[model samples]
Target: MRTKIILTATVLIGGAAFAIAQTSHTGHSDGMDHSAHQQEQAMTGAALSEPGQGAFAALSELVRVLEADPNTDWAQVDLAGLRAHLVDMDRLVMDAVVIETDLPDGISAIATGDADTIATLRRMVPAHAAQLARDDRWTVDATETNDGIELRVTSEIPAVVARIKGLGFFGLMASQDHHREHHFMMAQGKDAHGH
Candidate 1:
């Protein structure tokens, strides 16, 4: 009876260990599959941001049209020019420099610089104004300063400009968040082995 009880206990323990091992193995396999899918998406440019999606979709359609008919009208298939303009717009947004200042009512953000910067800011103002109009929490005023253009941004809440920095035409519409994550991960001083 003592030997039979010992064998039964051993079998139970071994079964539990096998179950735990199988669970961990299945989890690891699912993780690998998910990682591969994400890698595939990144490889295929499926991770484009909003602006990138617009540009990519336009270009893709243009390619399809051209492929269907090599003699397609050059005017109709001029998406490359449109793509170039989109790139320029993106560059203007990414290169914009915003300076924030404290105000009695709210925060003030000044986007000013050289002539070229002023022109870019001016071009972006209508789009920003449209966005601000949609959001009733903020108000904006624009004026030409001696150096460049000053945009006085006010909101009911504090740090409004900083909060809304990623929304308007002046904001970066591309998928640069991964770069920021990589930089943060590197700054954390943790290696691949989690050291």
Candidate 2:
């Protein structure tokens, strides 16, 4: 009786696995075998069968190469398909975060020192911010500062808002000096006289 029960359990589990393997999934773009046999092989440590596998393989190779010798110059490293998932918009925001995050600690914000950088950044992030605003992701708030225009994103994320209010992303561009006295610029650099 115990032997029969064990055989029955094994057969039932195998049947369920077979049923799941036949169904198609829509969201994932990678074309690969989703069969139970393939899953079992993966569980057993075989090579992964998916589109981004090559990307992962490349990353692994990069790590190995770097590990073998730590002095690998960054510019020489090949990053093919390394950023396949990042959209242009996300890339721009990421760039802003990267730059702005480098500002001095405890600073609520940092303004761009050059007109070119400010204009370009504004063109990139504000549009995304505007869309987010419409969706109530942020409230459109623009204030004139001593150096240049200051765009603020007022959102409902209290935690993020608190951090931004405390140690946030703010800055002024050196080009628009006229707006200076009209607003209290946060950082270094004196009034319009290129000071």
RMSD to the hidden true structure, all candidates: 15.4, 18.0
lDDT of 2 at 80: 34
lDDT of 1 by residue, 84-189 (tens): 4445455456666667565654445566655666675665554444434555667767665555456555667656645545343244223223323322232333
Query: What is candidate 2's lDDT per residue for 1-195, written digit by digit as tens?
Result: 999999999999999888777554442356655586577887898875353554454455545655577665555443432322122223333344322332122222334445544554554334433433453433544444444445564546765455444534432222123332311111111221211
**lDDT scores in order:** 0.53, 0.42
Candidate 1 Cα RMSD after full superposition onto the native fold (Å): 15.4
Measured with C-alpha atoms, the lDDT of residue 9 in candidate 2 is 100
TM-score of each model, in listed order: 0.41, 0.27
Cα error, residue 104 of model 1, in Å, equals: 3.8
| Candidate 1 CA-lDDT value | 0.53
Candidate 2 has its poorest 10 consecutive residues by lDDT at: 182-191
